[model samples]
Target: MSKKWSIAALVLYVVYAVGMYFYIFHGASGGVPATLKGTVADPQTFMTERELYLSDDYSKIRNFLFFVVTPFEWLVYFLILFMGISRVFEKWADTKWRLFKNGAYLFLLNLFTTIVFYPIDIYRYSLSKEYGISTQGFSSWMRDYVIDFWVNFGTTLLIVLVLYWLIQKSAKKWWLYAWLLTIPFAIFMMYLQPVVIDPLYNEFTPLKDKELEAKILSLADQADIPSDHVFEVDMSEKTNALNAYVTGIGGNSRIVLWDTTLNNLTDEEILFIMAHEMGHYVEKHIYIGIALYLLSMLVGLWLISKIMPWMVSKFGRVLNIEKVSDIRSLPLFLVLASFLLFISNPISNTVSRYQETRSDEYAMELTGDAEAAVSTFQNLAKAGLSEVNPPWLVKIFRYTHPPMLERINTIARYTDKNEVETEQQAE
Candidate 1:
């Protein structure tokens, strides 16, 4: 029966992979947009021949790994359950304090999985280094890796312990209870992240360029955003990639620019980028995102509640688990949750892309600088070696923001529209 399940898992993943290949490479909508033809938004303009070749290679491998990793993780979970590794952890965790014992189990489980996944993680880092994306030394990279492991382990341990406690309290409706708790917990994390969690990995300080800081604050003031300061993180030490974002919640919220961005972009281009991020704040994308997340979790956890018992009843022996509330049953729960999340990628990405487009439009309106916006995106593509036009399935599965081609073309369209409007007003 375990063998049958394993075979079924492999077959299902194979079918998904085959479908993905055809959908990405041979789908009907694969081509440059109508907006880009004969325009400066050509892909050829974005990168040198050597850089383009390197970017294409990097994108293909990254996309391939995206599909492979999820199924691999699911299978690893199954293997742990089938091989009774969870039971071994349970034994090692035997103690008087149930929470402590569960923590031990979680730590052991995470340690095991970390070891199993280390090669993939390290290889990803190596790939970034090879592509000139990452500048950190291997030892520094390893330090960050260790920090990430402990952080994730601690977070998972806390969440899982609460989940199990909820299960003990109400086996039938624990998912509902857990889902409710998730809202406040998520908000708490958001509030704490910028001040606590983020500082652990990188140094963030007030933007040192007082002139640029004043410009950014002035932009914020015009946008009616309460921000009085701009923060910059020293990312040039670790990465060549450029990024800026608004993070945290309420008073904790602030705009942050990567030092790489400040170093690489002109003042006008930086303002355009900053305006784009400020759009997210003005339009309340953060709140909307939180609401959407809760809604998805509400439905997903409800489905898990129904499916977990059936699995436990039917394959309890094969999976070496007795019941849904058993801590050892975590691997099965994770497998189900992950599978659901994987299949929902396209839906989530569609919503994200829409939000990003709206933000882009808002930025164009606020900045009224089409040339700056265009140049900013062009520089972004060059800096990151980004593939401006990727496959259809890649857009659906991987793209949260519009492709660079689409963004630059949109700026062109916006420019033309604004010029026509100005002429009409004069007439």
Candidate 2:
């Protein structure tokens, strides 16, 4: 067999074995059947890892579509459309939309792009619904999209203006200045996202289950995280997928759990997941991610500063752009940014997977309940319809967390070691 496919088969076998162990254990113990718990509430049940993870033809097809669609979105739809628009408006390039031709083009560019690409977005959402992941209605999805569009509209407008302003002021070292400015600007945006922007999409409230809240807070306390920052978001409106995340920076930072996760998981499982999230805050991964991204942007902007001038000389007239900052140059600017983003994906994902694996260990250490860690991941894999082992390319390019099989194995190893140590102490 080919190496990649062989590796895929081996990992998939691991997933099946682990899943079978859980199914048999739960069945024998009379632990809550997934159906009774409303965990896998659909009529089409997943009984084994092959069924639960590997055998989902819909998800695999959709994922493959994503591998195709993303580059199309970035390189084709986003790029070619803008290029076409600029050429179409060739005469008006300098004078037609004179007032709106500068920084305002950022907003117009995004609006046009989103409109052209909105079908792709909706098709993706539709696929999620078909696969039983999304619970959102079409109208509700559109409403959220509108809110997202305006948010982007505002941010893109500001980013383009500042970028251009830097370009005009310092022709030679503008990229360096902009790169430095991006660090603060990026952090400032992160600080605002949880507070100002997230509220528009979903409702957030202090977790109402007091006993559960206290347990979560205790874990936070153990981790030296502030108790008040843990909030539960109403995610059941939009999705059935389980998740928790830490967002914002400094005082604005908060830990958020999807209500879907709360409703689906046991309290013990929930605690382990929350502790894992707390580890992110404890480790300051958000800051680390921001720093890494800004560092990449520094390199990306510098490269653009070098290459953009040359592109302008070649395609300037066709693109209705005179220089790097012409606002009309936004598409080409994104071309460079997107290329950098594509290459950086694996690097960033590798760093994230390391942090995630460490956080898994941290949670195991904090809770010392290996069973809960195992169960937590098992249920999460089921909840999200995650392929416990995707193909090799997907693992490197797509996943930010280690596969479910690897995570379960990691916890089992730690669990086994702990038991051995206890037995030694007893002797």
Candidate 3:
């Protein structure tokens, strides 16, 4: 209903198109390699081959569908549906949630919106299943999905209430105050993510293999991180993908490996992976990442402050809204936020990619094992079904880690053990 919202949406779509064109043709990561020096190995083995592998025709289709088609569908079809549900159901002209308070209305609106998004989500999950990327059963996935929806609904409703209250209180300066508040709230959420949120779906325990745990602890010791224990999550119960990462903040932080990672990868490969995870802390990427994102989000909220009043002015009367403080106009605000998020994706992904690059370098330097790094990626690609040199379009939007070929090449370049040893000896 708002042309201001429509304009923001148009800009997002146009940028997406341009991004696709440039990414596919020019690529985001510069210096495209002429060839991959390594060999392709069987998916079951952690061994490397002399030849490199590319996405097969099937994989290309999967990539296209996942990265391009899915988002495009979200933009064109689901977004409209999403906004319509928000606009219509937000009023609650039909029913009530027990007491039927404003929070209750917000809950229905949010729940409806999430429900509208679910079919598309299920379809995407189906796509993942088809590609052998997900082993989650339909029932189990739906149960998790429902749990996530309720958790998010409560949190979002509270935030929406706070935001509108702020809007009412300040009228013109609410965005500034909200931005100030967001910094700590976001950090708190990050601090709680591993402890409060992650355990809901996955069960975590101390890493069972003492030899491997000791190796990990030794790596942590070398990194000067006081991590006493390494953790393993039973991810094999849900999906076949392999991963290991560091999470939480302060004393709650843990280095977590998926059971699948332990089962599928050798100690050497897992060590390389653990080193990569530890690199984030060693290089202070966690703090840096949060700072970068917080700044980006601050800028975004500033933009929202500038744009929202314009949206209110353009459609205030038509949408039956008199001012920016009206909770009824939250749907329009959310649409604008979605557009901003779309526009920010590339920038955010670029920052993440750069940090990942730093971690990869640190891992290679710390582990002093080029063979392990290379094989680590090879084994991971096998488990995750990641393509070497994923299409540039997919790479720009979807990849958080550097491409397999690029990382392999970087690791391969770290062949001089003397350099690593020299650095370690100095340390």
What are the C-alpha RMSDs, in order, of all predicted structures? 2.0, 9.8, 5.1
Counted clashes in each candidate structure: 0, 0, 5
249: Cα error in model 2, Å: 2.2
lDDT of 2 by residue, 149-237 (tens): 88888887777777777887887899998888887788788889998999999999988888998898888898988757478999999
lDDT of candidates 1 onward, in order: 0.87, 0.73, 0.72
The TM-scores of all predictions, comma-separated, are 0.95, 0.83, 0.82
TM-score, structure 1 vs. true: 0.95
Cα lDDT tens digits for candidate 3, 184-250: 8988998898988898888889989999999989988998988988889998877878999999989
Residue 21 of candidate 1: its Cα lDDT?
60
Point out where model 2 deviates above 4 Å: 1-55, 77-84, 87-100, 314-322, 424-427
Compared with the true structure, what per-residue lDDT tens digits does model 1 show for residues 249-324?
9899989999999999999999999999999988999999999999999999999999999988988988989988
Clashes of 3: 5
Compute the lDDT for candidate 2.
0.73
Worst 10 residues of 1 by lDDT: 22-31
